[model samples]
Target: MRQRGREGLREQRPVATMEAAEGRLSSEDSGEMGGGMAAAAVEGIMERIQSDDEECRVQAAKEIRRLTKTSPKHRRQLEGTVVPLVSMLRSSNPEFTEAAMLALLNLAVKDERNKIKIVDAGAVEPLIGFLRSTNSNLQEHATAALLTLTASSINKPIVSAAGAIPLLVKILRDGNLQAKVDAVMALYNLSTLPEDINTILAAKPIPPLVNLLKICKKSSKIAEKCTALVELLLGHDEGRMALTSEEGGVLSVVEVLEEGSPLSREHAIGALLTMCESDHCRYREVILNEGVMPGLLELTVQGTPKSQSKARSLLQLLRKSSYSGSELQAETLENILTNIVAQIDGDDCVGKAKKMLADMVQVSMEQSLRHLQKRAFATPTKQSRTKRQ
Candidate 1:
C-alpha cells in the first residue's frame, strides 16, 4: 500500500510541472505578488487612519481617497479600515471630516458591496446631518456618498426613512451649485418609487425646486435635473397640486421648454401635458397664461414624435377648456398650412410657423375681446355709461 501511494504521488508530478510551465501555480520564486503588496499598502493606510496623530489620519485619508478613486481593488479588503473612516466624519476636526468623507465617497462609488458596508457602519445618519454642513466641500462629498449609497436597493429606504429626504431638499435649495446638483440627483433617485415621491412631497419642496429651476441658467445641467424632478413631482397627487400651487412652477417649466436641453424640453412638454391631464380648470389656465401655447404649437412641427404627441395632447386639452373643437382645429390647420407653404417657398419654417401662430393667437384674442365688449355694452352699467360719454 505504501509503495502504491508513492507511485500515485510520483504520477502527480507531471501535472504540477505542467501547471508551473503554464505559470498557473502560485510561486514565491516569481517575486513579490501585487496582491500581497496591495494588501500590505491597505493595511498600512488602515493603521495610519487609526493613528493618534491627526496629520497621519488626514494623510491616510487622502491616500485612501486617491486609491479608491483609481480602483476598487483596495476596497475589497476594507473591513478593518471602514470604522475609523466613518468615525472621522463625526470628528470636530473639519479636515478629518472632509478627508474621511472624500475617501468614503470614492470608496463607496460604483461598488455596491462597499456601499452596503458603509451604511452598515452607520454612515447614513451622519451623512444626512452633514448635508446641512456649512462646509461646502463636506456637503458636496457627503451628498455624493449618499447618492451612491441610496442607489443600493437595500439602502434606498434606509436613507429615506432616516430623514434624509427633507435635509436633501434643504441641500437642494441652499447648498452650493454642485451640492445642489448632487442633492437634486439624490432626490431624483430617491423619488423613483411612489412611496418615495409621497415622502418628498410631504417635505413641501416644490417652491424651492421651482426656485432651483429659476436660479440655474437656461440649458444648464442643474436646469435639466430640476426639469426632470418636476416631471416626477407632477406624477403624484400632492406633487401636482404642489406644483400648481407654486406660482413659479408653470413659468419655470415653460422656460425650460424654450431654453433647456432637448431632454429638458421633452420632459417639460410631458409635464405640461400632465398638468393639463388633471381635470382642474385652473391647471389648464395656469400654463396657458404663461403664454406657452405658441411654444407648444412650435413643438408640433419640431419636437420628437413622442413630444409632438405630448404637445398635441396638451393642445387638445387646452382647446377643449376654452375653444370649440372645430374652430380650434381650423385655426391650427390654417396656420400650419400657411407656414408649410412659406417653408416650401424658401422661408424659415420655425420663423414662419411662430409668426402664423402669433397671428392666429392675435385673431383669437381679438374675437374673444369683441365678444366680451359686446356683452359689456349690452349690459351698459352706470360706470360703462360714464366711460362711453
Candidate 2:
C-alpha cells in the first residue's frame, strides 16, 4: 500500500516536487516551465481510495490529504476525488470511514470549490450521522468537516437542512474541548446569516453556548467565537431573552468588550449595541447603568472603523436616552437653554422654568469639564491610554 501511494506520488512528482528545486535554481531551472499532474495520477489515487483492501484505501486517502494540504491546485483539481470520499464516508469500516472523512475534510480546507463538490456529493447527511457516532474521534473529524463546509456562504443551509444544528449542539454540550470549539465556531459561522439564526436557536444551543462563553478563558478563540455567535443570536427576541436570563449574561459580554482580543471586543460591542437598540426599555437601561459609556467613548477614538461607528452609535443612543427626543434636541446645551429662556416670561411662575434651564446648563458644563479632564488624563502623552470598562 505504501509503495502504491509512492508510485502515485511519483507519477505526479514533476509538478509536485518543484519545492525541492526552489532553493537551488540554476539558469536551466529558471527556464523550466511549471508542471501539473496527468489524469492518470488522479485515477491511481481514486482507484486506491476505493481499493478492496482497507489499508490501501486509507493510504490513498492520506496521500490525498497530504496533496490537498500542500497544494491548493490539488484541492481544486479534486473533482474526481470528492465523489469517492463522499461515498466512503458511509463505509461500514469505521477506521476507513474516519480516514475518508478526514481526507474530505482536508480537501475542503479553505478551498471553496472543493467544499462545493463535497456538499453536492451528498456529504452532509453522513457527516451529521457521524456526530451521533459513539466514536468521539469520528465525531471530532465530522464536526471539523462541517465547520469547513459551512465557511462557504452557500453550504450553511445545506448543513442545517441535514439537521446538523441539534447534533452540533449535542456536541457542544458533550464533546471534547477541541470538538466543542469546532462546533461553536461552526455555529458562529452559520449564525452569520439571519436566516440560519432561527435554525440555530431552535436547536436550543444558547444555554450551553452562554456557558461556553463564561467558562472559557477570556479572549481565547473559543470565547471569541462564542461571543461572536451570541452577538448574532442577540438580533432576535428569543435570543435576547435567553442571553439575559443566563447568569452573568450581559456582564459576560461587557467583560469581553472590556478585555477580550480585538476581534472579540468588536463582537462584544456588536452584542451590546443590539441590546441598546432593543425596544425593551430594560435592555437599554441595563446597558446604560452598566457604565458602558466610558468604554464606548474610548472605542470611538481607538477602535477599528466599524467598531468606532458602532461605539459612536451606541453613545448617541445613550445620549438620546438621557433626554427623551420628545423633551427636546439641540445643537448644544446653550441652544436648548437659549430656546427655554426665550420662551420664559418675567412672571413668578416662569421662574421655575428659568431655574430649571439654568440647572441644565450648569450640569452640562460640569459634565463637559469632567470629560475634558478624563480625556486629558487618558491622552496626555503617547504612552497614556484609558482603561475601558
Candidate 3:
C-alpha cells in the first residue's frame, strides 16, 4: 500500500511541472512576437515617410523622431531614411521642420555614419537658414543639429563652408541659454580643424564666450569646451586681445584654473600661458592680479602630467615677474617653491625636492639663455648689418 502511494504522487508531479514550463515558453514566444510587431510598425512608418503624401510624411517624421530618440537599434536600422528626413528639413511648416530636425539630430547622436550621410544629403544649407529663423525652437534645434553634425570630422568643413560660423556667433550673442551652450560646443568642434580658427575669430566670439564661461559651472562640460575654445583662440592676436578686452574674461579663466576639472584646468593654464608668452610684459601683471597663485600651486601636485608641467612653467614665469629686487619678495617665492616640493616629495624626501628645484632652476636658466640668443640672432646690430652690407 505504501509503494502504491509513492507511485501515485510521482504520477501527479509531471502534470503540474509540465504546465508551468509550458506557461514560461508561451510568455517568451509572446515577447518575441511583440518585437516582431514593433519592427513591422517601424517598417510601415518608413514606407509612409517615403511616400508622396505630405500628411503621411509629416506623421512619419514625427514617429521617427519619437522612435529614434531613445532607440539606438532603430537609428542603425533607419540609415536609409536620411535623405527623406533631410528633405523634410525644407518644409515651410514650423512643426514639420522641427520634427525633421529633431529626428535627424537623434539619428546622428552616436552613429558616425548617419552624421556624414545627413551632411552629404545637403542638410547643411537649410540648417544654416534655420539658424536665423524667427521661431526660437527652430533656431535652437538648428544650432543643436549643427552641433551634432559638426561632431563628425568629415562634416566640419561642409558646415563651415555653408556660412554657419557667423550665425553661430550670432546665436552666442542673442540665442537662449541652451542655444548658446550648443553654439559654443559646435564652434569648439569646428575649431578642431586647423583652418577654421581664423574664421571663428572673425565672428568676434570672445565677448559672448567670456560671458558664457563666467556664468556656467567651472566643472561642467560646457565650461570645458569653453575653456578649450578660448585656449585655441589665444593662438591669434585678435583672439587674445578680444579676451583681454572682455570684462572679467581673464578672471573667468583664472577661476577655471582654480576650481575646474583636470582637463579644464589644463586648458585654463594653457590660456594663461599663451597670454603671458605672447607679450610677457603686457600680460604678466594682468594675470597675476587675478590671484592665480593658489590654483597654480595646487595644480603642481594634483594635476595631470601635462598640467603639472604647465603649472611648473607658469609658476616659474610668475615667480620671475613677482620679484622686485626685494628680499621679502624673494623669500616669499622661496617658501612657496619649498612648500610645493614638500607636497610633491614629502618631508622624508627633502633631498629629492632639492634636486628637483635645482633641475627647475637649470631649465629656467637654459630657457633664458635661449631667449637672449634668439633676440641676438633675430635682430642685427649696426656692426652686423654693416658687415653684411
What lDDT tens digits, residue by residue, belong to model 3 across residues 80-145?
Answer: 789999998998988878778877887787678898999999999999999999899899889888
- lDDT agreement of model 1 with the native: 0.67
Candidate 1 per-residue lDDT over residues 1-389, each given as its tens digit = 00111111111112122112111111112222234236677778878999999999999988777665535565566656778999888888888888888778767766777878888999998888787778887777787678767767788888988989998888877776656666776888788766888778888878787877765655665666678888888876787888877755776788778656677888899888887786646676667655566567667766777887888788766665444323332354446545644655445665655554544453244444444345335643211111111
TM-scores for candidates 1 onward, in order: 0.74, 0.70, 0.76
Ordered from best to worst lDDT, the candidate numbers read 3, 1, 2
Clashing pairs in 2: none
- Backbone clashes in model 3, listed as residue pairs: none
Ranking by TM-score: 3, 1, 2
Question: Model 2, range 201-254, lDDT digits (tens) per residue?
Answer: 888777787666655655566667788888888888888888777655675576
Best by lDDT: 3
| Cα-lDDT of candidate 3 | 0.72
Winning model by TM-score: 3
After aligning candidate 3 to the native by TM-score, how far in Å is the CA of 237 from where it should be?
1.4
> Lowest-scoring 10 consecutive residues by lDDT in candidate 3?
1-10
